[model samples]
Target: MSFTLAIVGRPNVGKSTLFNRLVGKRLALVDDQPGVTRDLREGDARLGDLRFTVIDTAGLEEVTDESLQGRMRRLTERAVDMADICLFLVDARTGITPTDEMFAEILRKRADHVILGANKAEGRAGESGVLDAYALGLGEPLRLSAEHGEGMDELYHILRPVADEFSERAEADAPETDLDVSDDAPEDFTPSAKRPLQVAVIGRPNAGKSTLINTILGEDRLLTGPEAGITRDAISVSLNWLGTPTRIFDTAGMRKKARVTDKLEKLSVSDGLRAVRFAEVVVVLLDAAIPFEQQDLRIADFAETEGRAVVVAVNKWDLEEDKQDKLKALRTGFEKLLPQLRGAPLVTVSAITGKGLDRLHDAVLRAHEVWNRRISTARLNQWLGAMVEAHPPPAPGGKRIKLRYATQAKTRPPGFVFMCSHPEDLPASYTRYLVNGLRDHFDMPGTPIRVFMRSQNDKNPFKGRKKAPPSKLRKHLQGRKAD
Candidate 1:
């Protein structure tokens, strides 16, 4: 196993800024607000040749109540426990405060290894504060400026030995690799077990998205409460589900565009959208009592537009009294509201009580399979021929449109191209018919399917054409023609 490092500090101390620098991306949300980072975020960090998993945690606060800050503190403490080493940060410019001293004592008691870092130590301005960090008794504080990219070499020097030890231990624990050769076996197209499945859980505000993810992880890894929009960033967690390695992203609740006027909410929504785009499979969580709302349909539509494998998860199912009737109604509503996602897996789950999660998992796997499925060209053409025969292309302006051939262009939300005489004249309804036909005939239900109409005439209109003459030349040519 690789080494894990957790950056623990008080709010507004540039821990997140340092995290972005190490991870080589601006992933964590940074603001003047103290508690912008309410959850622990992990990323693969690299400094020089040393690489390891680094966690950016919420600011350490002395709170134990059920308030937001208290919950954030608990989550950060959990990150400290999980990490192999803790990089406890203090603001060198402001000097060590009471909160920082308290956290340092806690780390000394709980963490196995702790590295002290004095951030914002860019120049002589912070020298006095850096000296004060020595009083924390962790060690000689690494004088660093997270914003100005200073002291990275010193940080690297400190981490190299830890990384080397981890490497040696990992090598010792590694099993022997078999070098047997097989020449007669066919190559497998299925994804390997080693690669974790990437899944993003998304929904509107207070749809129990974080709750469901917490349940899946079987721990309070995420902060959840009666509050709406408690989550502000797309936090991802790694897990082993039913023997399958999976990385699930728990995104902030997305509100409708018109209602989202707050700048912070907009950023949160954009982050969630990015998560959906990056995810291999997206689970659109819906409130069981108010399932299939306009925003739910919009979210599902956006997923389809992105050509991602989609699974609809109705959360809060335990609260529904008429289970059978409600499920039937949900199915009917789903089919009617989101026809583009017809036949997609719709699993009822209660994120609060962890009901129907197995079904949700199975559905997600099935949807992923369909998304990656590829059809043979011959079979695709055969299906196309049958579909065309059943419903011939409409004749537009006395010319009959002919679809000459059809072939799958790609998979992962399977796209196809059709060679046709008049690609532009093909009506939207006809395209829908063909797409639905492909879905039904090929058993590609619930996956977004794309159909492209290509004009068979490949001849360039400008090929072998002479350049137009200038005005004078044109006049001379006209006079010569007259003569």
Candidate 2:
């Protein structure tokens, strides 16, 4: 029954500061810059008995000439459309401006309920701006100093009425029938309070996946040796990394299906694939001696395609005498062989001697963080703007292709949806351009990246398409007449 409120205003008006104060968490990055908050940030909020969802938005800017504005519009519109109410924040010290009026006009057209807020209204200096906010015709502005934690009682009163109405409606629609809460409790199925992050360490048989995992766990949990196929079953172990619980799976080394003859080997390979599906992050190990072998690249590609966050670990670094030469060779191999997963992290480590183990952990953590990373619509578009300016989308049908908007449709492998005028006309090279741009901008080199193209002309049904096979579509289209 809690309502959703979006805090929106011009840049440097303390929107993020107020958001941090309201949420009681420093989730949003706060800086003394105009456009530090480029994306919309959502968090649960509370003030006294009133509880609701609050969204922190980027400073509203009038940008028509910028290519990134389209993406920002999509993001802002989504937030405004979803929210039941909005809190339009203004700097009481700065007074009102043309920018504030412009935002008021936009919000007046969009939001059902808009509450004007006069921030930094603690002293005489802010009184003029507080009075100026009333001119917008939104209503009497709530005065408060968010940083000093003043005027909270007024804020509570302002929001409590809305909270009560929502709660009353929710109660009116509630079901009256009661049932036993623990009726289906199992005798032996005690649910653990924590869910461990499932991670799969997979590569060619000779690659030191088991060794690296054993190093991570700081124990010889999995049997390790020189021989291939020594570990057949996909053995999993529960462990903690810096207090975060994780389930690391040591999958059996996968070989070419043509060479996988025995029924048992086939089952093992199937189990490995199953592990890949279950994993949230996959560490694709590669032997430094023979880095980026056809099979190693294939494993990395599979991880990316399956939407699993991938990290490449080049094992046995201690044995390599020419470190720089080997690393250069490895990077070249990755860029050439697995261009699809262009910026995937490639951590060089000695799994046998435990050198660079800490770096490997850092790299894995960074990759995981990036996998879960969500950029504000504003920031993404800003970055997108720079990218487009650097290299525009290719020409199609004798005209320039326009990439209208981009947003993260999903993540885990960090999938993005780029809405455009011509999805089919967007060349693969252009997609690569964006992918490489993302990798470089985000410092997520050597990690799997995915960008999905969708036409703004039609609704994209991302669902069920995962199950649809391209071969089937080709088969159905074979010998078909042009429409």
lDDT of 2 by residue, 1-483 (tens): 889999888878888788888889765656665655544667778888778988877677777543444344455656777899888889999999998898899889999988899998988999999989989989999998988988889888888888888899999999997876663655321113256677799998878877787788896555566667655556566777656577788878998878999766676677788889988789998887888777887888899888887888888889989999888988888878887777777888888788887876676677777777666677778898888888888787787788877888766567788878777878788888888888888776655677888877546668446675568668678747443
Each model's Cα RMSD: 5.3, 28.2
Name the TM-score of candidate 2. 0.52
Candidate 2: where are CA atoms >4 Å away?
Answer: 1-193, 457-483
Stretches of model 1 off by over 4 angstroms after superposition: 172-193, 458-483
Residue clash pairs of candidate 1:
none
- Predictions in order: lDDT: 0.90, 0.78
**Could you estimate the TM-score for every candidate?**
0.91, 0.52
* TM-score of predicted structure 1: 0.91
Q: List the residue pairs that clash in candidate 2.
A: 39-376, 343-445, 343-446, 343-447, 344-445, 344-446, 344-447, 345-446, 345-447
Top model number, lDDT: 1
